[model samples]
Target: MVKGKIAIRRITSPKSRQVTFFKRRTGLLKKAKELSILCDAEIGVIIFSCTGKLYEYASTSINSVIERYNKTKRDNQQHHVTAAEIQFLKKETESTMQQLRCLQKYNRQLMGEELSKLSFEDLKNLENVLEMGLKNVRSRKDQTFMEEMRELKRKADDVEQENVELRKKLRVLSQDHREIKGEFAAETSSSKEMSKSSDQAMPDKDDIPERIHLQLSLQPKAPSLDAHETEIK
Candidate 1:
């Protein structure tokens, strides 16, 4: 015959509760020991009495069992985290690929290769963008040209100034040469004049001896006695 099920309730009497706790605790421990032996499994049980007493059992050391459980739980959590990260990476890669494709299509449209998908408004916008870009390019070109022109003008001015300086130096050199030539010509003329005056002042070589004879004759000569006797005879 099958026995009726007993209702599970808290025992109201203190003594009865203590007795029930002891019996249940012993039975639970026995069951755990049998399960561990028969199944070759590690098992653990823990209980706390109402009086704050503690009881525990384990096929292995409790500390070792607890440590193994924590290690397994941590490993499982890490595996889940790794799977989540992989999923996130996959989604990120898909999003990036989608963006890349969009960019490629947009680039093709800009190059006028894939324009069938563009509406009139989009074409107008593209035209405006191209026009603006052209305007900016032209502006930059003009700016660069002006800058180059200014640089050339500056260089030309420098060259012109240098030429003017060279011309001034040449004029100074020419003036100095003319002055030196004039002084040389004056010195030459003075030398020629001095030579002519010296020629005019010098006496002839033939007259030099005659002039010396006249000077000797002019000196008082002693009276010739023979000449005076001849005259008296």
Candidate 2:
């Protein structure tokens, strides 16, 4: 005979409740295992008894299933973080580009190149900024001019020092030339004095008359023209 269906209510007897829990747990695990095998699906189930006993079923290792679930969760979190960072950076870049474009537009307006788009007040403000810039530029130009002048003055001082040194050298050379000329004149005078002394120390012809006569007597006489002609004959 077919058994009548019993209503799913709490069992009054502790023993009956325990028996029911055991039977239901067994049936759930058998169905999970069969489903996994038939469908080639990964499945995992975990249950805890009132007495703190653990019951579980998994098509694969329970640890492997748990590890895979955790990994998938972590990857999803990391992907979200990366997407958020990328979006933030894109926004930051766009904001910076906008600021740069604004600055460039302001620069063009300041240079008076885009005056048609400017109001009178904007033009006045631009004019004031330009005037200030012009003043700064002129001040810098004056400072540069002063610097160049100072540099030229310093160079002139250096050149003057060189000129002074050259003049000192010229003076020294002139003094040396004068001293050499004086020495040369003194040498010439000394030579002249030595020649005069040698001439004076020699005996005069008049003072050596007897000596001169002896010299003449020692000389050979020239042949007379008449004697030469007789000899020739």
Candidate 3:
């Protein structure tokens, strides 16, 4: 036994093999105890002979080590449930992983990548979402268009008011010119009559009634989205 490292090949002699087993088993138990004590670690050792004899050692109380061993055994046994449960859990895990992969694929598709292997249900749902999104975009666009129209109308009103003011100023300038000409000579009676007629020509609320009517009539249309399908998904 002491000549060199023994061959890993099977031992032919029963007596010699038994002797080696006993000696090695004793040495292993001794080492385990020493290591446990030096490091303050819990240790348990169990050995079974070829003849089916059981041997055990523990650094702490044997009963405590045995209780721990039993707990470990129970845990190990419980961890391996029925084969049916294992299969069910495996199927569930596989299905979840597949769904995750499909969701990632769909996300890529939403970014405009061409794809393969998607279901009809996935396609239908995607179409619905896209349609709804487009509808919202159209609604917002219409809102902005209406607002821009209103702004344009307001600018037009401001321009018209400025035009009216300019017209008034022109009339006043003409009147001044007439007065200056009259101071130099005699002014025409027809020019003074033209000034009185121009003052009476300024616009009233009757001219702006159409614009007010348009503002009063504008309203937003509601989105015609379906309710049932959105609730289901």
Please give the ranking of all candidate structures by lDDT, highest first, separated by commas: 1, 2, 3
Compare candidates 1 and 3 on lDDT and give the better one. 1
How big is the RMSD of model 3? 40.4
Task: Give per-residue CA lDDT, model 1, range 1-233, as digits (tens).
Answer: 99998569998999999998999999999999999999999998888999999999999988988999999999888776676889999999999999999999877877888888789999999889889989999999999999999999999999999999999999999999999999999999999999999988999799999999999999998889999999999
lDDT per residue (tens digit) for residues 49-84 in model 2: 988999999999899888888999999887766768
Tens digits of per-residue lDDT, candidate 3, 1-233, equal 57887789767899998999989998999999899989998898878899999999888877898899899999998777888998999999999999999899878887657646658897778788889989999999999999999999999999999999999999999999998988765445777778778867866667588878787778565655676568768
Q: Is candidate 2 or candidate 3 better by TM-score?
A: 2
After TM-score superposition, what is the CA distance of residue 197 in candidate 1 from its true location, in Å? 52
Model 1: how far residue 225 lies from native, Å: 68
Tell me model 3's lDDT, rounded to 2 decimals. 0.86
Query: Candidate 2 — which pairs collide?
Result: none
TM-score of 2: 0.50
